[model samples]
Each structure stands twice: as C-alpha cells, then as structure tokens.
Target: MSAKIRLYVDHLLGPGQSVELTREQAHYLFGVMRLAVGGHVALFNGKDGEWLAKVAEAGKKGGKLTCQTQSKPLHMPPDLWFLFAPIKKTRTDFIVEKAAEMGAARIMPVQTQFTNSERIRQDRLQAHAVEAAEQCGGTFVPEVADLQRLDRVLDDWPETRQMMFCDEAEVGSALRLAAQEKGQPWAILIGPEGGFSDRERARLSGLPYAHVVSLGPRILRADTAAVAALTMWQQALGDWL
Candidate 1:
C-alpha cells in the first residue's frame, strides 16, 4: 500500500532499520491517525531523504517502524538565510513555517532596535520548521537559530554572503533583485513591527554587502514583508525558477 503519512524523524533511516516513535509520535500515528500495525507511512530524517515504512509495532505509549525502501533522495534548499525580528508568538511561528516551506537554509530571529519582542522559543520554532518541511515535501529542515542582536550579527557577517535588507523606509526607491549576485549565498532581513529605527537603517545601508531594497509602494507588516521578500528572492535568485 502507498504511504500517506509523512513523518520527520531524527533517527537514521535505511532498509531494515527500525525507528522508535516518541510518545507524541505514537499518539499521532496510532492514537490520532489510527494507523494500525503493518500500515504504511512515509519517513525522512533530513539526512536520508524519504523512505516508505510500515508500523512494525504499535502501542499507546510508543511504537516502532521499520524502513522498507527508499522513496526520494535528499533535496537540499538554496544556501539562503532569512533573518527577522520576533513578533507575536503566532506570527513569528508563521515566519518560521513559511521560511521552511520556501527553502530557507537557515532561519534567524534578530533583536532589532525597534523589535517588538525580545526573545523566542528556539526549540518550538524549530519544530514548526520541521512540520512545514514535512507538509511541503522537503527533506531538509532549516535550522532556527536563537535570537541575536542585529548589530552584533552584522558585525561578524560573512563578507562573501550578500544581504538583502528590506527597508520599509525605502518604499519609493524599491528595486528588483535582478542585479544581485546569484552565485553567492544570500540572506534577507525583515524589520520589526514598528519598522527599523533610523540608526538601524543607516547601519544596514553602510554595510558593503547589504542592499536596502523597498518591498512596494505601500508598506507591509513585518510578517507580510517577509513572505514578499522571500518570494522576490526565490523568483529572482532562488531555486523557484
């Protein structure tokens, strides 16, 4: 039978290798999904691509599944980073999800001068990324980095990677990313709710590797701007086209 459930596991997957499901996984599969023993399920561990497996053992607390055969090979995303300030818990989670679905290699929460939130649950956000990857048919789950000060992050920024600074203040001056160096790694920065402060914008502007591009004529909320920026980047320099 064809496997319908796609699960993201942390264990290595290969023919004959059994994966022990966690308590939560057990509930999702047997308890909630009502998957019975010998039922098929799709699995991936980020490193091993996708595999078709069956429920070898089933229990309420936990269970086991053994890989039968490989389904798809590992598909890595572009070498891209999406850096944004933490907003409301749900919105921040949304950004993480979209980043994962859109093939961001790494997700980072930046502490901007005008940032609305000062901290984030790194583990929780990482889980969101995994869920997004599973639903979007991706093998690689991008890393959700801990909250860091924007200035500090820029201070040690790699000179080789290009940065797309989404400047809300540069609305009229907005330009497409067509001229960007597609061969190099890229990162997109989305500002906070109140937008980047004057000092923050100036600092980003002076950075040699940074390009201060506007999103559109009308301003967009931080979360919306993130989706817009990622779409533009993907269409222009990412793997989308």
Candidate 2:
C-alpha cells in the first residue's frame, strides 16, 4: 500500500507549491510516524482531486509538503446515501467510518423524535469520514450532513431517489423488498435506539418512494442497523450487484 496522509481543508496544495501542514498533522507524520523529508504521501482535497506529494521539510512543531502530480481525477461516487439517527459519540464515529468504508456518497444524521443525541459535532464526524476514505483508499469522501429533523429531511426528499426504511416491525424475507428496489438511486434509513415514533413511522411508510424492509428477526442497535442495512443494500441494489 502507498503511504497516505489525511489532511483537512486548511492548507492550499498544488503542483510545485509547498503547503505547511498543521501542528497536529506534523506530529502524526514526523513524530509519530517517523516519516522523514523526501518521503512520498498521497493527499486529496474534497474538491481539487487526489495528488501525490513529497514531504519537503520535517520539523518538530510543523512540517511542509509539496504536491507533485494528480494521481486521479475528481470522481463522484454513486447516489447512495446513509440516513441514520445519531447515537453516542464513539458509536456515531463508528457509523461515519463504516458508512464511508461501505461507499455511501452521503452520510446524513437525521434527528428523530426518539433520537437520544441532540448535539452532534459535524466537524468531528467529517474528520472521521476523511480518515475512513484515506484508510480505505477511496478517492471520494462521503459528505457528513448536519443534524436535521427527520420531518425536514423527508419534506425535502428528492422524488427520484428511493428510500429504504429498515423497519424492525416487519418480520419476513428481505429478498421481497430487495426485488422491489433493484436498479435505483437509494438511501437507507435506520432508526435510533428507541426506534421511530409512531407518527414518524407512518410518514415514512406513506412515502411512495420509500420501501420498508427488515434486516432480520432480531433487533439491532442504531450503529449495527446502519451496517446491516448498508450491507444488504450493497448486495441487492448497490454496486455489489
């Protein structure tokens, strides 16, 4: 595997120009990773595309790197989105990481009536998404959306894309639902730990584009629900198919 370093949007990088990485990034690269000057690393700006860079200077407090050439063009991902209720801090981070790893184009934090976490640090979640992309060797990083009310998100939902609601209330085979959702841009909705409110469930079920599906016989946590739903989607209508 090639050496890669995840960077935030604070630094400007281009061919033949030196960009100074932040103090924290400097520590991780030079101090922790023991990467010396002249070592090559890969970088990507969510907008500017992926680039191969060489460490120009290694310093105790900070360091500089120069971008060499573009490794890949800015390619957009599929239209799949993972719309999930935010859980605890660590679990939420795990969900963001897994969503990026699973190739979700967008990770949305939907705030339901039964949702436990009201406050979500979007920057932290975005950072986790970036790290996941770098770790998985993915050129595109999934967008981490801010916390929005479920109703608001649904009200503004695009009519073209289908929403696969992972309903725990359903008890049957998943293939039936999978067959109905084949070959469409989709979003998977996972309820919070306490599950969706009655009104919310009804609203989701009423949507013409929403396809209510079951993960299995057992109940799952919000984080686990996300992974299971995404896995099922990938196997059925996603890229795996």
Candidate 3:
C-alpha cells in the first residue's frame, strides 16, 4: 500500500522529536482520516526534504509523529513566477493552488489599474500554496508574495528573466510565444478581469523582457488565463520541456 502523506511546517524533525500538527491538520488526521497510532505517513517542509514518519500517538485534539527516514531530496522548480491581479477570494485561492500545482517558484499578486480586488490576505494564500504542494507530492512550496503594484514589479524586473504577458487583445497563437521563450528563466503574467489599462499594456509591451502572448481565440477569465499561460510556459521554457 502507498504511504499516507502529511505536510508540516515545524522544524527540528528527527528520530526522537515530537512534531505537533496545526488544529485543522489535526482534525483531518485524527478525525477525518482516522490515522491511528503506528500508521505510517510522509511529511515535508518547504525547507527540509520529504521524510518518512510514523504516528507515535493519536489524540482527540492532535497527534505526535516520529521521523524515520528521508524519502526525497528537496527539489525546487525552475525560476518561474506567476504574476496576476488579485480576484475574488475563492478565485484567488484557486489561482494560488493551481500555481503551486503547476510548479511556479513564486506567486505575486499585482495591483493593476483595472484590478477589481484591492485587499488580499497573504497568509491565507500562502496556506493554499502549502496545501497544494503537499497534495501534489512536491518537496518545495512556491513563495507567496504580498500584494504589490504592477508598476513597482515592472520597475524591479530582473533583466535575465523574461516575462510572458498573457495579452487578451493579442491575436497571435500562444505556441509562437512559447517557442520564442525557450531556454530562459521566465514569468507568466495574467491581467485583471477588466484587463490591463491602455497605459499599462503599452508600458509592458515596451519592456525588453516582456513578450505578449495570446491563449487562443476566446477570451478567458483571469483565473483561466493564469492556468493556460502557465501550461504553455511549462511546456516551453519550464521543467516539462
């Protein structure tokens, strides 16, 4: 049988240390999953590599586990960032989850001129990324960044990394951009629901590292655009290549 997987953020895991789970994690393990004493599980931290562990004790509130052995080395994906304007709460969570699953190294919430959502809970988004990584058997979790203005992110753009701008107004095919972006550190940018302002689009188009791409004929929602853009990027310039 396959070993059950459980992720924890606590440090100092080893043979004799007792690791405490968060309240929700405890509920899932002890209540929902009914993991009992002596059951085996796998765990990982954003820092340490994955470890094989066993439940030492199970309680109503929480449980204790002992690390037994290392399962996989800590591996991070290629330098790919997902920059998107924040949307509704559930949609934002979905974006973060999908970004982690798709292997983005960093997730940035950009505040664009036409962006509808202004306030974002970074902690909650980070939690979603962690959960997604755990579910996907990933050793590393993507870093969730706090909300920042689009202009500032552009101003501080790294010269070496290319940016694939998912421009809805563009009529060209996504594959063209994908082929051109091969063999370079890249980022995929998705605009807000209302799309990028004229000025913002013009500025982005003028950037040396920015390559505007289209995700086919139909206009996709901001959430769908993010996923499609990432898929194209992963197939072209990312680990999937």
Candidate 4:
C-alpha cells in the first residue's frame, strides 16, 4: 500500500539517505500516529523532490527514516509573491495557509496606513505555511516574511516584477488581466480591512508596474479578498493556466 502520511522535513532527501527526526516529530509519528518501524512515510524537504521513506528506527524520543526512492519531482510554482496587510490573528494565519496552498512563491505581510495589526508572529505563520504545503501535497513551501511598512516594500520593489493591486476604491471595475504577458515575475497585493488611504491609493496608482483592479461590485474583507485575488491571478497569469 502507498504511504498515506506526508511530512515536511528539514534534512536532505535522497536514495540511501537516513533522516533523523526531532523530538516533536518522533512524538507525532510514534506516540500520536502509532507508526512503527518498517512503516512507510512520504517526505519532502522543499529542495529535493518527494521521497518514499521507510522507518528504520522508532524510539520514544526520536526516530530515523531511510529514503527508498523519489516519489515525485520538485514542482516549483510561478515566481509570484503574495503581499497583504496583516489583519486579525486568526485571519492572518488563514491568509498564510491559503497562500501556501494556492502556489504563492513567497508570502509577505505589509503594514499599510490603515492596517489593523501592527505586528505578527512570523515563526507561527511560517509553520502554518509548511503545514499547508504538507496537507496540500505540494513539494514547495512559500516563505512567510515579517511585517513591514507598505511604503518601504513599495520603495524597494523589484523593477521587473509587476504588481496586481486590489483597490477598494475601484469597486465595480471588471477584474481583467488578458493584456498582461505571462511567464513574468508578479505579485498580488490585498489591502487591510479598513482599505487603503487616499494617499496610499494615489502612490500605488502612479507606479508604472502596478495594475489596479477591483475584486467585484462590493467591498470584500481582507481575508476574502486575498483568496479572490489569488484565484483570479492564478487563472489568468499564474500556474493554474
């Protein structure tokens, strides 16, 4: 039977490679999951492709797994960054998890002028991204960046990367991107719950690479807008095509 458990590990994955599990991983596999020696598990390290591994040693504190063969090739997503202003605690986590599942190359949290939250637990959000990749059968996990000012991020934006700015003021505008060329680096930005200030909107509008678009006729909450924006971009210019 095929291994049903998929795990994201930090060690290298290759033929004949033995991976040492941490104490927490050991507890989850042995104590919680009831996996025993000789049981099979799927492993991925975000660099190497997924590998089918056999449990070589099972102990109370730690364990080891030996790689048997590569199960899947490393599939990298399009070079797309997901940028958004942090919202509530649970919703912020939701955004990070969904961004990982939806094929974002990187996840960035920006503090906008009207942003609700000032700081975020970067480690916790990153853990959510890893768990999301494991559950969604993805070989790559997007890195979650710490919260930064939106203005600063815009100032240092890459010249080659295009930005899809979801402007709340542009409500009722059709969400279209057919004119955009695919295969280029891109980013999708979702504003905070309170929406972007007039000054912020003006600054974004003046940018040469920013494509301001609306989600729909009505204003959407920050979390909902994030998912909607990702879906739209993926269908138009992302890997979903």
Candidates' RMSD to native: 1.1, 2.4, 2.0, 1.0
TM, every model = 0.97, 0.89, 0.92, 0.97
Position 153, candidate 4: lDDT = 94
- State the lDDT at 53 in candidate 1: 95
Give the whole-model CA lDDT for all candidates, comma-separated.
0.91, 0.83, 0.84, 0.92
Off by over 4 Å in 2: 4-14, 72-75, 173-184
Most accurate candidate by lDDT: 4
CA error at residue 150 for candidate 3, angstroms:
0.3
- The regions of model 4 sitting more than 4 angstroms off are none
Q: What is the lDDT of candidate 2?
A: 0.83
lDDT, residue 30, model 2 = 89
Candidates sorted by lDDT, descending order? Answer: 4, 1, 3, 2
Q: Model 3, poorest ten-residue lDDT window?
A: 173-182
Judged by whole-model lDDT over C-alpha atoms, candidate 4 comes out at: 0.92
* Model 4 agreement with the true structure over 93-172: per-residue lDDT tens digits: 99999999999999999999999887999999999999999999999999999999999999999989999999888966
What's the lDDT for residue 10 in model 2? 50
On lDDT, the stronger of 1 and 4 is 4
Best by TM-score: 4
Residue 118 local lDDT, model 2: 90
